[model samples]
Target: MAKVTFKGNPITLLGNEVKVGDQAPNFTVLANDLSPVTLENSEGTTRIISVVPSLDTGVCDQQTRRFNEEAAHLEGVTILTISVDLPFAQKRWCGAAGIDKVQTLSDHRDLSFGEAYGVVIKELRLLARAVFVIDKNNKITYVEYVSEATNHPNYDAAIEAAKKA
Candidate 1:
């Protein structure tokens, strides 16, 4: 597992650590309307999955908005921001932020995405900061597990990986 810290305090992460070249794990996360969405549903397109602890925080908000802005310029790429926040909150944040390019999904119900991606913060019941890029064939091309929960990811590297995919 990747070592993580939040505000200078160490935290435990539960789940297998995912790395580049591994097959992306399939998991069910809820859409804004509480409908189930899984990795199997987006098989043909290159995907960038942005995992954050919550959307209401400063870092998480900026991370999602950054991807949302970049999504507008990237053709044939699907960007998803996953968080433990409720579906209602995710929807509201997206609307208030004017984030139309990226789809914000909630992992509150089951933490399937959190476990599958190895991002769940054991102490807080939240997802640690991370980013993943999966190719059209479902193989992971890039993985970024931010060392600190309150930090940002390598947006350029993740975006470049998706472009190459």
Candidate 2:
């Protein structure tokens, strides 16, 4: 288990993290259209999994919005914002926030996304703030798991890594 904190309080998380050059774990998630989306199922696209705790929080919201804006200028890379939020809620949040570039996928059904991605907060129903850049073959290239809950990641570096993929 990975020891992390929620608002400075202790919380444990599953430890199935994918490392550099490791193939990303396969899982099913629900898209806004209620269709199942799987990272391993896609072909010919580099995927950026922007795993966030929840869209309701400030940092998570900012990350999603930033990725959405940055994705517009990139090519051949699909930015997916993965969260435990329900598909409807995610869609509403994105629409209200004017986020149209990144696709939000929910882990509400099976919670497998957290397990698969190793970001799920085991104590509370939350996910950790993480960024993973997967190449066209689904190999994890860059990964950042924020130790603190309040901090935002290096936006410029992540975008550059995604661009290089």
Candidate 3:
């Protein structure tokens, strides 16, 4: 179980999560079009798995926007923003935010994506905020599961790691 704080309240998560050097877990996430898009389909490309509790929250929205701005410079990589939000909501938010560079994927239908990555908060029905960088070979090279939900992650460091990945 992973332990993190939500507004100063301790929250314990349940699962054995993926770590750096582990074979990244595969998942089928919903796209904006409500189509099933599998991680395997995006193989051979560097990936950034931006796992968040919810996109509706202030921190998550900021994170997505930050990554979207940085994504343009990383020409051959795919930035995937994931949350438990419905695909329709993800689509609407992306369109409203002008979030084009990052691909917003949903975990509403099933949380296999959350469990596989070990970021699911079983108690809250949310995911632990995390940023994972997977290389072209599907090897997870960098991982950061935030210890506090209310806090934002180190975007600069994550970007540097993703660049290396």
How many residue pairs clash per model?
Answer: 0, 0, 0
Clashes of 3: 0
lDDT of 3: 0.87
Off by over 4 Å in 2: 1-3
Predicted structure with the largest lDDT when compared to the true one: 1
Q: Arrange candidates by lDDT, highest first: which order?
A: 1, 3, 2
Error of 3 at 1 (Å): 3.8
In lDDT terms, how accurate is model 2?
A: 0.84
TM-scores for all candidates?
0.98, 0.93, 0.95
- Name the weakest run of 10 consecutive residues (lDDT summed) in model 2: 1-10
User: How big is the RMSD of model 3?
Assistant: 1.1
For residues 1-165, could you state the per-residue lDDT of candidate 2 as single tens digits? Answer: 445677888777874877888988888999988899887655588888898988988999999999988888889889989998989999899889998889999988887878887888877777888888888987888888777766787788788888888
Better of 1 and 2 by lDDT: 1
Using TM-score as the measure, what is the rank order of every candidate, best first?
1, 3, 2
Question: Could you give candidate 1's per-residue lDDT for residues 14-131 as a string of tens digits?
Answer: 8878999999999999999999999987889999999999999999999999999999889999999999999999999999999999999899999999999899999999999999
Write down the lDDT of every candidate, Cα atoms only: 0.93, 0.84, 0.87
TM-score of 2: 0.93
